[model samples]
Every structure is written in C-alpha cells, then in structure tokens.
Target: MIIAVIDGMGGGIGAQIVSNLREELPTYIDIYALGTNSIATSSMMKSHANKGATGENAIITSVKKANIVVAPVSVVMPNSMMGEVTCGISTAVAECEALKVLLPIMPEDVEIVGLENKPLALLIKDCIKVIKKEFNIK
Candidate 1:
C-alpha cells in the first residue's frame, strides 16, 4: 500500500510520522513525503520515507497515487502554514480519492471544538492505529 505524509514549514511533524511508520509498518508499504517546501521534504526523507516531493504541483500530482493520506488538518486550509499551503494544494488534497487521516492540529486563528488537546506524540500514535485498521495490518 502507498501512504502519503503531507506537511509544511519545518516538517517536524511529518518526520516523526514517517519515522514511526517506518518502524511499525511493513517494508512493503511505500511512504511518500509531500511537503510544501524542500526543507519539509528533506526532513521527512531523513525519517526514511520511500519517496518525496515538494511544492504545490508535486503535492497535487503525488497525492493522487496514494491509497491513504496523513497530514495535519491545516493541509486542507488554504493559506495555512504561514501561507505556504496554497488554494490549489488544499483543493488537491481535499478532492483526492484517498482516505485522509488528519491530525486535529489547530492553526493560528482557528479552533476545533470537542477535540481533546492531546500531545502530538499521542495524536501520532492514534494516527498509526487508524492506518493499521484501514490496511488490516496485524
């Protein structure tokens, strides 16, 4: 199965996700790192994503091939990530056929009601569980 991990800015979150997935998922599961900038992509690559791409067009194109997409909720919000995430990028991600697993990470000036304010590590672990369930990975 192919999974895409999308992120922006410094990509610390994506890096952690990639690292954890590398450890937990089977080697056959391909992880694609889609980043808003080169730095983010590089960070994820360091975490051992199978492949990576950067910028709007790259993200738009690569996300189409993924069976699942993992990203912060901000990835779908245009003008988020300090304006690194464009409308096209957001639209592409939202419109893609892949099942999306988004972290409830609130960006500046935005608030998501009813979600517990959990630590990022805990949230990432939950994301792994969702992936496991979706792929029926034991």
Candidate 2:
C-alpha cells in the first residue's frame, strides 16, 4: 500500500516520523513524503521515503495516490506557516480510502496522537502497531 507522510517548512516532525516508520515498516511498505516545502521534503527524504513532493499542489495531488496518510497534529489546520492549504487537503484526507496516522491533535475519526521523545517513541510504535494490525502490509 502507498503511505504518505506530510509536513511543512521545518520538517523536523516529518523527519522523526520517517525515521521511526522506516525501522518499523521496512521496505515492504511504500512510503511517500509530502512536504509543504522543499525543506520538509528533504528532511523526510533523508529518512528514506520511496519518493518526495512539496508545495500546495504537490501535497494535495500526491495524497490521492496513497493508500495511507501520515502527518503531525500541525498540518490539520488550513493556514500553514508557508501558505494556505485550503479545505481540499483536509477533505481529501478525510475522505480518502487510506487510513491516516495523524499526530497530537485531530478531528473525530481522523486518527492522530502525540508521540516521540521517550514515551513519544512508544506511542508512535503503538500507533504503527495499530496500523499494521488494521492493514495488510507487504
């Protein structure tokens, strides 16, 4: 299945998520990094996403192809620091057949949580475990 990880400018969160996802999911799962900017995309790319895309258009369009989407709690909002993402991204994410592994804060049924830094890693692992449980990976 195609899994996408989204982020903006800093990409720090995306980087960390990709790192953990790589170790947990391995090459069996196809992971894509959809960053709001080049910076975020590059950071995630370093962690070994199958491919990378950036900017508003790239971000929105890429999500359609993925079977799963991952993003920090931050990206859920409309007005990103880099620019505006409109409601389309959220709608696509909300409506997509792919399960989203969003982080920290989230809307009801969207799928998200807080993780990393000690217990943070544990939380992410649990989240991934849940993802694995729900889907047929490789």
TM-score top scorer: 1
Please give, for residues 36-112, the per-residue lDDT of candidate 1 as tens digits: 99999999999999999999999999999999999999999999999999999999999999999999986889998
User: Model-by-model lDDT, in order?
Assistant: 0.95, 0.74
Q: Which ranges of candidate 1 are over 4 A from the true structure?
A: none
Clashes of 2: 2
4, model 2: CA deviation in Å? 0.1
- Candidate 2: where is the Cα deviation over 4 Å? 81-84, 105-119, 136-138
> Per-residue alpha-carbon lDDT of model 2 for 1-138, expressed as tens digits?
788998876787778778888888858778889887798899999989889998777877888888778886546566544453456666666667777777663334444444333455665676688678778543
Output the number of the lDDT-best candidate.
1
Sliding window of 10 residues with minimal summed lDDT for model 1:
105-114
lDDT of 1 at 120: 94
